[model samples]
Target: MSKPSLHQYYLSLIPNLVSELFFYIPKNEIRDDIIEKLDFLNTTNIFNTIYVVDYYKGPIEFKKGRDNTRLLLKDGDLDKNMFNLLEKKSEVPPHEFNYVLDKYFELAECLFYITNWMNTNINKMLPHDDTSSGIFYMQSLSYKKHFEILVKNFYPTKDIIPKGNFNALELIETYFPDIASQYHKPAHHPTEHTTPTPTNSVGVQEEIQPVLKKTKKPPLITALEAEKILLEQVFNVDFKKLK
Candidate 1:
């Protein structure tokens, strides 16, 4: 038989590896089906970032974009048209645009880094008894470790109760319930905090509650709650506001 290409081998092993990883994941933390869905998405190369709306259900959407995409950079520095297209196509709320974009970008960076590493090291990662498992094992371990760091650092104030060793979804849900409700309609009206109006009633110029500070939080996130903040503040996907 002809020697199988390294890429082909890596691709072939991904499914089984993903399955095994999912099997190791705690059930109550996240539905097996959801993990399967995520696996499918990753293996299929559909979305770079998978938004787990509800483990009991399915992903709300899969995002596509470069991990390095930045919002703060000038439009000329980026694929402005592409970014605009995503903004227009997305059902995300206006307020939550920056948050969502930044989160997805960060996630893309993580995934891209792993995938790129795999691609670069594929030659040396041939099938061997000790190292034959390929780079996925190490990649998965790194992902898990980084994921823990992400969870802790992102939501420092939130209470975190570990559901299980492998139940990342449960840990996420416990820390950020709003993310669980991402697919659900908003339950309340959008909160409006008033600021000084730019123009005075008499005509004098005054400060106005401009919508500049819609999002209020750190950008480095790894948990679903970070996703929620992005969706609500940047995308404006709040059900309450929609109603």
Candidate 2:
């Protein structure tokens, strides 16, 4: 027997949960095109040209999804077409993308509190320390671009994601002053802000990726110039293993 997919798990869990906020279904019916795109991520075909090797997940044009060179089906589903798209940019339509991305998040091993408390007053909720990296501590992440304009505009700068580590005190006083005002005041980054922009759009961006740039050997990813490239460019990094 195999473990259940993220979808299956959500279905089983949804029935028991009290909060209806955690839902996978779109308010309006899901578009057939989006359904096809979502379904495509579940199917893994070695001959499909999506994977360079015999398995899924890897490093290729981008660096985040897998440790190797090929892109993960799950991650690739959200990308825009290579011609018009870039990595980490999800294509799922804004209206339905939120429902879909939440489905994708099931794959990420993270704490609910991390997303839940990102804005609210950490000092009010918990003890704070000057040296300690607050709960939201993070310099930046790939998904920041997708955040709705409201969260984006909330910050004075265009690029809202910064401060590698989110400190409770810092977030309340400095970082997300508008929404992190919860408890003490009001909070934000509502569920609606998830619409994919260059990034948010979600997994069904209906993207058509070009064939992966395969490695010399399926089992071992090696290149003559790759050593220098990987060392200088990709080493110690989680994404983009190829040169």
Candidate 3:
């Protein structure tokens, strides 16, 4: 068989990388199917002991994006777009999802530090000298780049979630006159400094898009009602003199 290319070689390590990234889910809460898939990711069976954590369901609840697919990141950074798509594929509960994404966000930041990802200036702290944390930092960017390519290859669109008669692309085409221009992407994918344009399903520009159906659940977000109410009450007092 032909040898795996650099991208494919990194691609193969995802399950293991994810395995290393995530640790400590309570045994009772995890479903057998998810647990099974994750368990054998590195080893044959359940050899490692599952650690327990105090119950805390994470904040990234499922909501429908403008395209009506499961929305994982509402106001979260565009870097988190991958996690939004992952909600459908993994089908894990909110808490577990939060745990993994928290881990991912910390590591994924390596992609943005185009020049000094390793903080080599302060490398004197760690054990080694020349390689001093730079190798690990380089590896973080490498893994993040490959993961992006993998997501685009597999779950490239909201079409993966499959709503009723109409799909995400068709919905966008029918409504937005300028949609065609926004849909185009470059032929060559870059290894670093990639950014997603704002769009209906992209977790930005939420107000600009129209929703044909109700969201999966209202966004798991809340604003301070007291602020609104206080302002309205203050305004109302001035008008009380008229009555």
Candidate 4:
């Protein structure tokens, strides 16, 4: 049988990888709240658009060349619709916002490492132009802008107390030890931090539940779809070729 494409291989790995990284992030009240909010965001189509792509041309007129150079994250806007939703639902303190931002940064870094590994080992085997350069560049920009806005607004010139040491190898080892031992370099490490317990505010929960119930899709479906899109972008492989 022909071996799976580079995209297929990476796609198969992402859901577990993302889940592991997210879970391994040292738990704290702020992180918990962030997780809760993130969970809500994932339910919305706007979150998918933020990650996937946004249209450049709209009713608003744009300069001729500008329309073609559609940015992944336009004007450093991290989905204003989603942001507005978050604002309306939760009154997060600046410190907690900073805390959540730091944790989210850690998640982004973990994804970067995973993609970097794919580039080095797998992409090298494929045609040079077939490398995931363009896809990674755009996704990196999204990661940068999302975090940049958070830092500027919530923790400008502030020293963020890191919640814990993120030893990615160790995390993979703990959750998928055999996979880790085979694929990861040796080394790893968590601590719970004090933060406000989530009160499950009525507004956010109300918004979240309907979608979850309406779709009746399994929770893992989002992760699977996310993996499919990333793989398609990187390798132009059919999603069916994955998993």
lDDT of 4: 0.34
Q: Please tell me which predicted candidate would have the highest lDDT against the true structure.
A: 4
User: Distance (Å) between predicted and true CA of 89, model 4?
Assistant: 9.9
Q: What TM-score would you give candidate 3 relative to the actual structure? A: 0.22
* lDDT of every model, 2 decimals: 0.32, 0.27, 0.31, 0.34
Q: Which regions of candidate 2 are displaced past 4 Å?
A: 1-102, 105-119, 133-243
> How many backbone collisions does model 1 have?
21
Q: Write the per-residue lDDT of candidate 2 for residues 59-79, one digit (tens) a residue.
A: 222212334322223123212
Taking every candidate in turn, the Cα RMSD to the unseen true structure, in Å, is 20.1, 22.5, 21.7, 20.6
Q: Model 1 — TM-score against the truth?
A: 0.22
Which ranges of candidate 3 are over 4 A from the true structure?
A: 1-15, 18-128, 158-243
Provide the lDDT at 192 for model 1.
33
Ranking by lDDT: 4, 1, 3, 2
> Model 4 over residues 1-243: C-alpha lDDT tens digits?
997543353344333223211101112212333334443323433221213222422222222233324443332344452253246325556655445445444544344433333333333333343324444344444443333333333322222424322443333323223333333333232122222221111211112222234345433223333433443443254544223
Query: In model 1, which regions exceed 4 Å deviation?
Result: 1-98, 101-129, 159-243
- Model 3 lDDT tens row, 81-162: 4544354335656655444443333333222221122232223323353332433344334343433333233323333322
lDDT string for model 1 (80-161, tens) is: 3233424443544654543533343344234323332333333353323333233234434433333333343232322232
